[model samples]
Target: MKRNDCILAAAIFLFAGLLSVMFFLSGNEQGNYVTVTVDKKVYGTYPLDETQDIEILTEFGHNNLHVENGTVCMTEADCPDGYCKRQGEISTEKETIVCLPHKLVVEIQGAKPNGGRTEEQTDGQTGEDYDILVK
Candidate 1:
């Protein structure tokens, strides 16, 4: 191709590549919110939809919780006090929501996709074994 034509083509290619990169980077950001509670009280809110690890230690013991795609679950905790870990995984709008001493926990299942409206149907509930997650 002629010199001018070659330069024009290269510029177009560069712009397209740059646009692709920008779109990719912007799309990588997830925007879901989750509220965490400790001992029946609200503690904090954090980005909910992503695979990440958080360690919490209460007056009782320490435990590791995993947050992924708006779902939070216990992965590990101090074996001596297995309260948190034993609670198991929670992924519903109404969740476990508490930690006794280390004073940390979040059990919530709001609309999926962060803000999708839920049907709001319920049989009316509350039982230990019927929890959102079971160990």
Candidate 2:
């Protein structure tokens, strides 16, 4: 191949890689609300747009939930490791902050499904349904 041909190939590869990175970083869809669960049970669901402090008091312990600027995070917890406090803020669907010791799970829930499809239209279910199965 000529020198010009090699340069063109390299440029194309570089551009493709840049585009891939941008898409990967932007793939996270904005979440509309957050769900807090304790011991595998739904504790509460809070809107992301509302800024407030929530204290979760379960039999295990307490977790301080904070919502600010459309982001939810565990500001403080009584768990031994304090991992939940370090999990930081989340503002995207499927993102979660778990406190294993307290069995606390804080996860983001997207406002709507992709492609304007409702739950029934897409999966024929009005509520939660198992879709993925591991073989």
* Candidate achieving the largest lDDT: 2
Model 2 over residues 1-135: C-alpha lDDT tens digits? 699999999999999999988887665543487777776566777878789999999999999999998898899899998988998989887678878788777777776343434322323221122222111
On the 0 to 100 scale, the lDDT of residue 18 in model 1 is 100
TM-score of 2: 0.60
- What are the candidates' C-alpha RMSDs? 7.8, 11.5
lDDT of 2 at 121: 38
**What is the clash tally of candidate 1?**
5
lDDT of 1 by residue, 18-76 (tens): 99999987666434445554443444455677688877665556667789876787787
For each candidate, what TM-score against the reference?
0.46, 0.60
Superposed model 1: Cα runs more than 4 Å off: 1-32, 58-60, 109-135
Model 2 misplacement above 4 A? 1-31, 112-135
Error of 2 at 121 (Å): 16
